[model samples]
Target chain A: MRDFRVLLWLRWRQFSDGLVYWMRVLGYNPKSSGFFEKLYPLYLLIISSFWVFAMWGFGHDNAVNIGSNIHPTSLADLLKAIPPAVLILQVFVIIVALRSTPLKLSFADMSYIAGSPIARSVPVLLGFLRQVIFRLVIIAGFFSLFALVLTRPLAQNIDLSASVRAMLACIPLVVLTWALGWLLGILRLVYPGVSRWNYLWVLPLLILLAATYLPAPFLWPGQALVLLIYGIAPWWVYPFLALLAIGLVVAFVWFGNRINMILAVDESILHARVAALGLLAFRQPNLLLRIRLQSAAAGRKPFLSLPKVYGFQTLATRAALSYLRHPFMLIFSAVWGGVMAQAAVWIISNELPVQLWIGWLLVVGIAPPVGLLHVFRIDVEERFLRQFLLVDGLQLLMADVILPLIATIAGAMVVWLAQGFEPEITSIGALFIPILAILLALCGAVALTNKRVLQTRILATGITFGIIMVVGVNFSPIIAFVAAVLSIMTLGGMVSQNA
Target chain B: MADKSQEDGPLLKVADVSFKYGSLNALSNITLEASPGQLIALVGRNGAGKSTLLKCIAGWTQATSGEVHILGQSIKQNERFVREHVVLVPDTPPFYDELTAFEHLQFNAQVHGWQDWEDEAEELLRKYGLHANRNAFPFAFSRGMRYKLALCMALLIEPKILLLDEPLGPLDPVSADDLWEELNGHRNDGMTILLSSHQLPQEAHPDRYVIMEQGEIIAQGSPDGLRKSLHIEGPLSLDALLRSAIKSRKAVKADA
Candidate 1:
């Protein structure tokens, strides 16, 4: 037990040290005696409070009445109510685990640890334990809050024992979900392309659960017998259910370990291939020039000049070339276009009123700009713009803002066309409003914030999305215009402040 | 002469090694060997496959054909062995963007399980005149400082073989002198060093120099041996000798 405690402590220290190292690399000094540093703990406390409060508020009614008076007549209802909460809790745990483990077992950190004389198993075990502990704490906190808040209200109507049993039944389910999430997160390290496909697993699991119609008597004999005596289910089902749950947990752990091993091997090979390609491509002059140009454009420069092309053509050409090469842009365009096409057909066939198309327009309109932001931000982060500043003898401060504006305009045109020219030529003019707004926003962000425009834009967009969802606002042209203006102003203010 | 099997083992051997970038061959049908504790200078013009050869030996770039054996063990069969035994100080050292000299040393110590090496790292940093800037990021440093930091990292690893590519490119005279002193120390410790540089210093005294052109080694011998064979002045610089060898090779080919 002492040795175990020591190992845990050592692992925690290593994880913390690694996090601190990376934070320092990113120019963050959390321990510094600055105003922001002092307030950081308070800020974290506030965020955690917000998360807890929001989750509890959303979950309270369902938690208290889990299996009491509102007896689930169909398996679909039971599955829907149970899986959502479980999935949400699972996602929370997975996010915590994913965010923590990278710090503990990053390539650089692992390189150091692997060289040590200590047993290889020690670091691996410790890294896994740290991730598990972080995940468990988040899950336990949410569960405990739900249990405390909902128990009294739920017990008033339903047999408290049955309710408690049902909640207890969910423990293994949560663990299984967590294990699956961890496996997927680990897989991402090896096959980054597959990481986004994680959502596909949940639908199948939910479907399977919905199909299950086993009654308590068969599924949990000991518990059913006990519940029957106490007017819950029957107490006979408890022991059987408990054993099944134990088996599930064991299976989960085994699968999780298998995933870890598979991913580790895959990551090792993938990294080697990337390194080899990097070496091979390093000496190619044309390739190097392209890389240099694209890197510069991404760095948020307003203009780049080749030996041939002068002025805006230089910057525009570079931007166009970068967009052409970017993989995510292709993926986003294909997916967006496909989804929109399907929706347009579905809407026309259903005759679901003209207003429904407005929602589609809004979604389609927002997709391109958001996608362009991602591509633009990659360049920013790579600091490719800095290289252009040296070569082109032109200030790229405006170029960075202009490139995104152009992409946003192009995206808006696609969205406009997808709507089949709604409101005819008049709507075309209105489309310019949003494009201009987005352009202004992007420009303000890049010009004012300089380095942090991308991050701020994302945060602002998320906040806007949350507000729109919570308020249940109807899609309107006027609302779109207002949003465009506000976004532009907000981003512009941020950029100006930075400048 | 190459048939001596039971004699002293070659420090490095690359047999039938081929490397390709897509369809373009970077190295092909290449074979080379070096004796234990020998300092071999690999001289080639840019794009002459010198860097690729060094990378293959260092286990950074795997050969597409055949094998590279360091101390008689195939690098493919035991990469960890190569990693532990050989270190590559690339022309542009891969640095942690954010780590300071002190932090990097601490990381190396923890990674290598050298519990008491913090003191050693500190002493070395002070010895190398990097003590004052120990806490600064490598990005904040000059090119020369970055080179020193890389050199310091390489020194901390203490590998049996060091493969350097233009290691002296960014160094000032004083740092170069310090580096030469350190290299002398490593030589005394029987560490085999393989390096390529366009500008060879007078003091390096590399045991042999391999002059390559158009992706093939055109001449190989001790610096003195090459000079004597070619009837040149005593103690000729590697760069001058290489230039002379290339000219002679071209003349011979033209005559043929």
Candidate 2:
């Protein structure tokens, strides 16, 4: 316990120092800018205030037009519908929860805590506590906000008090899922035998889904369990979930006692960095790949093979090989490009101002979360400017674009084929491809040209390009291609002989 | 008049070069020149602009003011001309983790348009005793090994001027000696090597020692000349001479 307090105090001090650093950077680092840097904090404040007000207005609007009769023919059907949906939601939530496991200590913590005489269990307990706290906050905040926005629609059809209480029940349900997720993750570390048991969380969910249509006597217990909690006993779920959370914490600590500290540390050190960098991954996409390399096994000694091309084409081939050799790297790029298409399509299809909030968040969140436009990071890495300064800036820039271009175009082609059912000259999805090319060009240009705050620049450029692509999707292909060519010329201006 | 632009002039020259990070001058009006075959050791305390000066001359950084001329042409306007002849090995060498040790050298050789650099690459690895793990990623290698790999890459490029920033810090004593011997060989071949470090290597005497304090070169000379300049009454090691020079300048500043 004393060791835990020591660790907590250390974390608090680290957080406080980081706060001061950010305060200096965000407020105005005089060393970074002249007078323009000082105005940023103010600009951020004004924009944030308007955003808050806009969300509240959006919530009010959602509250007004909700569930205006004709959804459910009977109340029992609605009650029963809740259990299965919640069960499936738990599955998705758990998948996201187990992204990575780590002891979550920095180098300083390793020095202090590992050297301390306190029991090994303390660090493990602290790790779990920190993980659980952060995990629950993320899950609860996202889901509860979703529930709050959605409950307004439910209130129109049902009694306001009962509906609010039922909707509020999701918090505890999410809490239960958090507990189960970490308990399973911890059990895997302490007792590898129990790792296989984690796959069973989906069993009851599957049974519940099957029992909805089939008359299976064996699946009734699972179905009844979900229904009783989600539908019948919404009031008492909070205490039950609190008890589950407490029980899980005890299990994690007990499991922590038996786990090897050295093994955990080895497993966790790089992951801790990856987790920390994941927070700012949007702001610094280059950091994501850096950590990925740091954690990756150093035995990757594959010989590089390049084409016999005589000029800048050799660099293009090597850049392409960088994508091909790193396993699943090209796939990740294609997936992010597809996500951009989906988000852009959403923005084009949706008319409501409130829906645009979701669209904007989707667009901004995609950069770090989906790692959209990470192909640009290859140039930022490898001290590339020093490595190939003799190469013409345009060709170097062109080489960097090849992988991102191929991946994004393939992705855009996927979306275009899907939306090609009633393809008109104006409504064709291929029209958006040129606009995506321009956005990608913007991505490469900023990464190659700028040396600081690349995350902010990329985010701003990506979001702006996303908006332009959405608008372009509505225009003729010729106009979009023209915009793309103009943007490509804009790319030339962003580069210099020294760039 | 002999054409200075024809490859017979001073190998490296920084004329009124200055670099500023925001309002702080990292390198302030620093001027230094090195002829071919000169091994110049830049000795200074940390944050003394040694690395920044090297960077400006290497064309890795653009100076805030003034020009760095390599082979009698401004590197600012002629990056290709300078970059072709010079390379800066930063303190921490960067590796593309995706590439193995041999691959890194191969990539550099191929990119630099060297059609057959395999024998040179193999010889450098064997010389560094890294031939055994030539196929491995350098991230797991020791600091000494990483430094050797970086050195190997630079050597293969065979730049006329090699700018090494704090090259001796990560190297072991024996490796350091071996590096100096190789550098000695390079000097014989008329390649200028500029090394920056906070301390001097043991039993290794550079042809010229440039001492910098607070972003400006306070003194530049041979060991005997530095001893005389600082008014050291007797023979002193390079460390003692640098210390005395720093103290003498501080006292002069304080008195003024």
Candidate 3:
């Protein structure tokens, strides 16, 4: 216990130091920024105020109409609907919170902590504590504001006694959500390489959908138990649920502890798996094949085969592969394609005007460039710029910009085919405009900004799209031609400056 | 005592060190310890574990091992001990691209828990004749200036045990001479410095030397001892002697 405390202190110190360093880099002196930093609490207050307002807006009309149609429903129905909604919201919060954990547990930071004289268990425990505290604060703040708005409608529907019972019932569920989030957060830290588990968002969504659609009696015991307790013995029921919540919290902590222990012991296994995937890049066969094909066709000597790429090229290629190989990439393309096809069908079936069809087509054409911006954002967040800088910038640009463009175009073609668009030489020309737009955006992003790439890309896209929209509204071929020329010049200027 | 004399005991020991990629292992057997102040130069061609070993000792690659004990107590067990006792000057200076020589020193001072690093950094920069270009970004500075910056960072740390990998690769003659002078000053302070370099130091100067062929240590001892064992002449240069020794060792291995 003493060792753990000491370790925790050391970890805190390290975190504090790192935070200070980052702040310094960001040009925030502790002495100078002290007042400004304190204003963060004020910022939070403003955000909370806005959130409260939004929630109140949702409930405003409902609150007034609450007593007008007081169909005194059974307690069971109310209990059933509320728990699932709360559970779903709790899960949504948990997934977003857990998503950043793996990134935070980077090797460099871990090495620094591990090398310190602090006890091993302490750092791990402290890490878990930090995440839990952060999650708790966020969850509590969000729900507190949400509960404020909900209180009015809830009060009108139920008597004070029932309101108290429902709040008490919610206490355990909130505790359980916090505990589950903490557990998942630790898992994210311990096994950062395992991306499959990041989709813990699906769990909450499933629980939410199930709660809404599935019959209350069949789905959860908590709701039914809460109702029974409220009816038969409210006092005993609150205590029972409280105890259950405590038990769940205990179980969650124990599970985290067990997993942490296993991770420590099997850290090598995890390391090996991560190394094989991250370092080797061969674990991703499609990417490996592409690299091989590119090398063979380009008639360049293969750098290192599986493991020899090293440094930035390795990281960039891996990023590209991960983005390309994701199942969602295909799914998103298909969905968008379906949307376009549906629009086409609506135009034909409803005998909509040709102008409306042309408008829809233009919107769909603009979609690919807009979509490319999102991909660029993902790349930036993945720290592709750091990796990109390591290689010959042009080669990196080709690998990152050109290859992904090809992949996205292929995806677009699939969407086009799914929409029953017949192949034509001129149909291929439709791709040129979007591709040019994406390239111009990429070049501008690289040249203009020193900030994080994602921020730069998003900013660039916004500006480009804004201009395109303004010009595109006139639907003049001359304006379009001028926009293309300007975009090309901007891209050329950026490339030359970088060169 | 006999065990200490035996080559089997680790030259270095690392403990509880974990490093990662987005989630991976750039390095992790890390338990290593060299003999007391031996001028052991880690050589493993490229990425043959030389840099990683140096990094672990320097506290760059924290021990994914068990514990890094210099003499007995683990360095990882004590933050202050590791900080003041061990120092690492990387092959490339981990300088902020934006910061000039003076600013980097200021940052280093902060990292080392120095209350006033700016003055100290300025003093060091002036002493090293880097004051002229102190305001220049590391990118604007020549390779030699960058090397000087790394040396300056190491000096600010004031470590007893200095770990340098390819320290001399980037420096010019004057800069190299300045480094040797600094190293000599540290030596006078009883500092134990372990540096890895492709270019061998003057044999006449070193207290001892260790040559690594693969991952394994091939030869280790006083420069003269190595010279005698390898059957080299008196006043032989360490670089040529090493080449000859490596050649002979390879021949013997081939015969075996």
Candidate 4:
């Protein structure tokens, strides 16, 4: 217990160090920092207050009315959806290779924690508990807000006790989900064979997704859980969920104390590095990406030899080969396309208010191209390789654009087929994805060949235009087209001058 | 000042190329040239801008107020010409983490549109002791292995001019010797080399030595010429040449 206290004290110091690291990353040394730079976070906080107020006001006004006897369908329907919601989250956890629970220590942390005479398992178990406790606190903050929103409605309609029960249910629900992820991490240590098959876990998720379309009886446990949340299940259901949550946490902590955590620590370093990259990606993205690629685990080399595709075709083919071998680019591109497809489905269903519909459309519309932030980035640092026979760097840039766009279109095609060949929205999405991708690719290439301090600024402007264009698309197609035309004009001017 | 520029156009020419990184002079008034078949060693300590000089020649970085001409044409104006004819293997290999060593060779060959370089590549892989791990990605390979793979890729191109920044910095003694032999083989076949190193190898027999200090070429000549001119007593090693060059330059700078 004393050792655990020491570890927490160490973690606090590391957390402060992390803050300094981020500040340094954002091109600031605290000693040389300017006055305005010091005020930036406070300025942001002031601006964000308006947004916070708006959201809080809406949540308070609307959520409090849920128990009003005026509407039976919406609240009841929401209650029934709770179990499926949890299942979706669990599926997401599995998809990301159970990385939702980030139990990791940096190399620096290892020197302190591992060097201790305290049993190796004590530090690991304590670390896990510390992570879970922090996450629980954040989760509780969100729940308190939700209770503020929903408590009145349930108090008016169902009863005050039901609202209390519902809020209390959030604790075990969160604990179970996180504990399940931790247990998987422990299992990975115990059974490498089973860990290798983790990718296959996605198949059952797709099946569960399909099953949701069927009758309520088929959902079984999930259906029962939903009823329990709505306070309509057998009385034993509450205790059942509580026992399940507590059991998983106990098992994880107990099992953690037995196994050697060196392997887990080693694996966690990779995850931790990737997570760090994700944070610094917004600043010096290219440099961060280069570092990530350089450090990346070079898996089993693919058997495919370089194809004899000549000219710009060769560049495109090279990218295709990379996608095939690496798979992450293809996977993310497909996910972006899937998101677009789902948005299209929802839009076509005509369920949302006009404002919400347009907002969702813009978000999903801009996603695919943004997902391909590094599409034009050749993983190699040797500039000479590209220009050996390169007529123009733009031709090589075009090649990168084509692969991701094709993947996006292919993803949209899959979802289209899955939607039983609905052509109206999906057809437009397929076309839009490529057009936006080309514009983004053009931006990336222009940034590369046309070296300037304005590289980041131009990208920022393009993103601003994209955000505007998304809203414009719903209001007037003419406006959206004008935005595209203006973007192309800007790109042409930069390229013609720089090239 | 002694005129180091060639009378007739040299194979590769750098004239008064100076670079400043925020007032830190990385390279200052660096003038040198290489004939078609010479093995020139660019010897300097770290921060001496040997890599920067190579980068300027290779067109990886631009010099502040000077131009590099290869075969009597500005490299900036004829990038494709330079890319086809010249290769610069940077200190750290900028390898694609996803591509295997063999794939990197295959990729370079295809870019040059060459179809029959496989045998040459295989020979290179064997010579550098990477034949067994040719299919492995360079990311997992040791520092020397990565360097070898980069060297193999550059050699497969068969460039008229080759620039190696810290050529033997990452390699083991055996690999270094193997590479030196391969480099000599290229030199005999009439390829030019400009390599930088902290200190010349004990076994190295460079045709000419260019000693640099604080971003300027302090002295340049054949190994024997440098020893004779500087009045060195040792067996004319590169280390002896460098020491004499550095001492004379410091005394001259002090006088100035």
Give the number of the best model, judged by DockQ. 4
Candidate 3 at B80: error in angstroms? Answer: 52
Clashing pairs in 4: A67-A153
List candidate 2 stretches off by more than 4 Å. Answer: A1-130, A148-167, A192-262, A273-285, A298-314, A324-328, A354-378, A381-385, A425-427, A451-477, A496-498, B1-4, B202-205, B221-236, B240-256
Per-prediction share of native contacts kept: 0.00, 0.26, 0.00, 0.44
Candidate 3 lDDT by residue in tens digits, A1-499: 8867666676667678766665555455656657777675466568878987786554443333332322334123444555565555665657754643322343544555444554444545465566556655554444433333234333545333443444444555556655566556556545546534646545555655565577463345345334532445455656765676677556545544434333343233333334335424533333343333322223222222212244444444443443444334445544554455455444554454444544654554334332233333333333211211223334344444544455455554554555454566235435443554355445434633344443454455555544654575478545755776676567545643342
Q: Write the per-residue lDDT of candidate 4 for residues A1-499, one digit (tens) a residue.
A: 7866777777778777776677566554656568987876566567678888787665444444423322445445555665576577666554443432235766665556655576545655666676667766665545444444333444534344543554466667667766777776666565555555635555547746575686353344455544544567788777877898899878877766654456656656665665567455665556655555555444544647568765566666777776665566777777777766666554454343444444554454333344353544553234644434444555555565566767776775677567654576455545454555456555655665544524543553456445545756577655665676677667746644343
TM-score of each: 0.37, 0.76, 0.36, 0.79
- Candidate 4 lands at a TM-score of 0.79
Residues B1-256, candidate 1: write the lDDT tens digits. 2235315568788898888878877787777887656788888788878888888887667789989987778888665567667777777664433235676565554445455776778878987889998866555567788778777777876777888888878888778888888887888887888898887666878888888776667788987778976667755876677778888898889999
User: Pairing residues by index, what is the TM-score of model 3?
Assistant: 0.36
Residue-wise C-alpha lDDT for candidate 2, range B46-96, written one tens digit per residue: 898998898788877789998888888887677677768888888788776
TM-score attained by model 1:
0.37
Best to worst by TM-score, what's the order? 4, 2, 1, 3
lDDT ranking, best first: 4, 2, 1, 3
After superposition, which runs of candidate 1 have C-alpha atoms over 4 Å from their true positions?
A1-499, B1-8
| Per-residue lDDT value at A379 in model 3 | 34
Judging by TM-score against the true structure, name the best candidate.
4
Clashes (backbone N, CA, C under 3 Å), per candidate, total 37, 2, 22, 1
Question: Can you list each candidate's DockQ?
Answer: 0.01, 0.30, 0.02, 0.37
